[model samples]
Target chain A: MVSDLSVLLTDRQGQPYSLTSERIKHLEYLCESTRRDIVDTLYKIGRGHAGPSLSMVELLISLYFEELRFDPSDPKWPDRDRFILSKGHGSLGYYAVLAQRGLIEKRELDTFESLGSRLQGHVDSNWLPWVELTTGSLGQGLSYAVGVAIAAKRQAKDLRAYCLLGDGECQEGNVWEAAMSAAKYRLDNLLAIVDWNNLQGGVTLEVMPSLEPFALKWQAFGWHTIEINGHDLQAVLQAYHQARQTKEKPTVIIARNIKGKGVSYMENKVEWHGGTVTKELHQIALEEINARLSELSQYADEKYGRNHG
Target chain B: MANWKKAPIREALGKTLVELGDRYPQVLVVNADLRNSVKSIYFMEKYPDRTIEVGIAEQNMIGVAAGLASLGFIPFAVTFARFASKRAADQISMSVDYCRNNVKIIGAYAGIFTGAQGVSQQMIDDTAAMRAMPNMTVIDTADVHEVRSALLFAAEFSGPVYIRIGRDEWPVVFDETYTFELGKGRWLREGSDVVLLNSGILLPYAVEAAELLESEGISAGVVNMPSIKPIDAALINDISRNVGAIVTLEAHNVQGGFGSAVAEVTAANYPVPIEMIGLRNEYSESAPNDALLEKHHLNPPWIAAAAKRALDRKNRLRC
Candidate 1:
């Protein structure tokens, strides 16, 4: 129960680089299943975010399954690492991770976007305080994370704050304001991840006022930047590790990913940011994700044993 | 007129914070680098670790406050009224109000008394803007003592609260015994002809106007309204029905501020003749506080004059 982040990260539960082949396979399985779950859930709901939700599946899976500390039994665990989805529009992905980790009841997933549902379209903190901050508007969650990190540091608490923002959200001036504060305070326990799919509102960021030299932007703001392929589980885990090792400054991981990573027709499609998933499109998506799942299943059987989840 | 006590309302916050930090360690102040002007430096001097100065970034200051609030800390996000209500309005609206976070938004230099920082700095619409927000408890305490009382009350309040304080020292209306509560108005005077509905630093002006009206044979009552959002609708309805006429005063725009709030309540519950004395629908120029007050017609003379007008309307309507 010591309030030390180094102790939190390097504990016997498992360190960053210690990812075994079986653990990687398990994470991959979680990723495919999460994608299938998102597509299934969005299909039933008939209209929910698909593109932005589809892009960051691995990014969220690694953090919940392999990174970040928390007890699902106690959402208010004082020592738990905090997570905020700054790109709250892409909430289906975050919800999948929460369900996969058993942080939320799996049956509750179907009630998303329904009247009085706990799982709001954009993340809500009302019923689920573990969500930390209710953020549908972009560019606000980073500053909130900065506040949480400052509070944790001030109290010498081991709780680390993590905020995931969209690449488009970086255009907001509020993000940089928070960045300056985090750097000025040299908050090493704070980590900001930009899901750098370079696509927002159905247009490539290059077409819009682009985020060219994005990593250098964080560096100029005095952050330790880690650029990586977001879908790669090992890279995502290592990025989390590198962020932990950096001292005297905050870290930003520019996770390069596709707008729609798993689905064929939806892959990199600009319209899919919140594009509706039709019955035909849903079937294709599940088929594609299941194909990946079966391959990971065979590998798990070879390395370890038959897996149930 | 005997010279009344005058003290800076802005000083009470910092002084109280110093003590508040000692008592409630979870209480923190998020600053936008106007610590000296807003007198938050007093708290910083005592508890440096408790102050999170965001250095001139209002949006980040609010967002940081929301974050701290999410972590169950009482964060008073302090900045100029323009920055708190206008510049970062969305941040406050979405992050603080919509999220219903337990954060105190402190808008300093809230009126024409911005020490000649002028047009850009003088924020007259803060009361209007903040009061328009849902789930936000808007309070503009009248004096230094009431400001301290409100701050102490805010520590106990759970939802988002917007507290507006003027910059320079002005006339103090209430004594140290005046306690603050949400959605309540205290009657400063009781008159049958007309009522002066006032909020914020203009309380003394309304009081003075009531006294002046008494000198003239016009019986003008004064009611100090510290809470604006959960406004004193019951008191306002009582005045409108029984007192017959109302003259509303604030150091803000007359459109959607304290005056309009009264008008809205009376229009629905008990309709009456309401005269508003504050900034007309226009921007104010940079000038000395007194000059700005004089130019905006928010001084005691203008308030007394407005009350007379309301009395005239009341008598005419009766006939």
Candidate 2:
């Protein structure tokens, strides 16, 4: 059944996202394809953050493909929902998703960190106009996101602001200051998602100043907290929807992610956070990811109708 | 308005901001609990809805202002100069400057020894610190009139601006006809012997020193350089050509403040014998304005002495 694709997939104002077998299958394809592109690109680039980039693949896929509303053609469209990549080292993953939407060109992707590549090591708004906030330093994006949300509300516009921050990024005092102000303003339209990968520079959170009582901390800051497995697409979508409906307060989704997810050897390996993906290891990782594609595709078709041939 | 009636520069900022709000609907103020002291409270009283109280968080205040600027609202983020420069430097660099967000950062009680708030509060590095950041326009108005003009200038001007203002009521230097032009300096007095180029509240001293030099047969010119960064190099070059000696002044460290900018201008083109008059590579003590000014040789008599020293160096260079 072909449905009208014009309405935004974000909220009740648009066609709210429902979990059908075919839709889930398409989202899963996007997730896996995004990971493949990232791994491929990072391999070519010779140097990049792979683990943190890999950890947030599903989240970015869910945001760009289904939840966050935007027109790729008119990127600077006023009233378009804004997204802040506060965890700026995750630029490769962001660039991959943006490329899928065809926002970033192939040449730009090839020249990722090299000269003339608009895509800097960190997210740069000067290079990418729609980047919203060119973030690299942690704990600042949520404040920018809150400001955006405040501006939207003041203008009586329905556009929302979303920020994706690393687990380690939350340790910044600015984040809590932003959190306190966001709560004070009762910014219902502002949603922050923490990539709770439990690692900072390959060290466990326990060793670092831990975000151990993380959820309660947000709760204490008067935020509606949603804890979920970061890799779970269904829970991710549900958390986003709940956040949109929540009023009189801001919402935070503590996506407990693995620093290096998906590929067997890389998964949960702290060292892979900054380690190089050799050509030998790249091939093995691709095969591991490739092996799951057909099985998931068949299972999706068996459970529900097919979205594509 | 009395010609020399001392009024708070922050008050001028607050009053003018309200006028800006009346005209520009997109104008907003982001305060970190310094409204009463910084005098953004005037704008706050007039437009409470437009004022965003971030509650004493400087970094978050800047980020929020950037966010607002991103969405087309012009946000004036106000905080003490020291906190804004040092505490939120990275945020200003990453979120505002690098992103090219059109936000106005008001640094209050900057480099003023009269603050009594302690040496920690009096910031001598705000100009030096902000001047280093790319895409930041630094403006240090000398009085109420210039502060008023600066607020008007900042509203119409696009991109990031760092405006240094004083917390307490201070002396007025400019008249009613005074208008602000960024990247330009107004030559207040024409003296061939020596010229004192200065910005912020120290312009009166420069003028008084120039008058004192005239009595001593020393033609001392005075240049009000409000636009600190992207400084008027041509004016400095022209003035340097006419004058034998030059003195650059600010309530900041001579290392990277107003003096360094003037020296860079002349150094690049026509190198001149410049005696930079400022805090002599040291921290300022929390004292009365008169004591600090007198102690630091920033008052008129000391300024005249410095100009003579510069003249002596110029004479020595000729010899």
Number of the predicted model whose DockQ against the real structure is largest? 2
Per-residue lDDT of model 1, residues B1-319, tens digit only? 5377778667776787777787788899888998888888988888788889999899999989887886778998877888878888989898889889899988888877878876888888988888889899999877788888888888888999998888777777767787898899989889999999988888887888888888998889988888998998898988988988999888888998999999999999988888998889988988887787788888788888998888898899999
DockQ, all candidates in order: 0.68, 0.85
For every candidate, the chain B TM-score is 0.97, 0.96
lDDT, model 2, position A302: 28
Cα lDDT of model 1 overall? 0.84
lDDT score of residue B254 within candidate 1: 92
Q: Once model 2 is optimally superposed onto the true structure by TM-score, how far is the C-alpha of residue A68 displaced, in angstroms?
A: 1.0
Worst 10 residues of 2 chain B by lDDT: B1-10
Please write out the lDDT profile of model 1 over residues A177-275, one tens digit for every residue.
999999998999999999988788978787877678888889999999999999987788778877888899999999999988888888888888885
Q: For each candidate, what TM-score against the reference?
A: 0.94, 0.95
Instruction: Give the interface RMSD of candidate 1.
Output: 1.2
- Scored on chain A only, each candidate's TM-score is 0.91, 0.91
The residue pairs in collision within model 1 are none
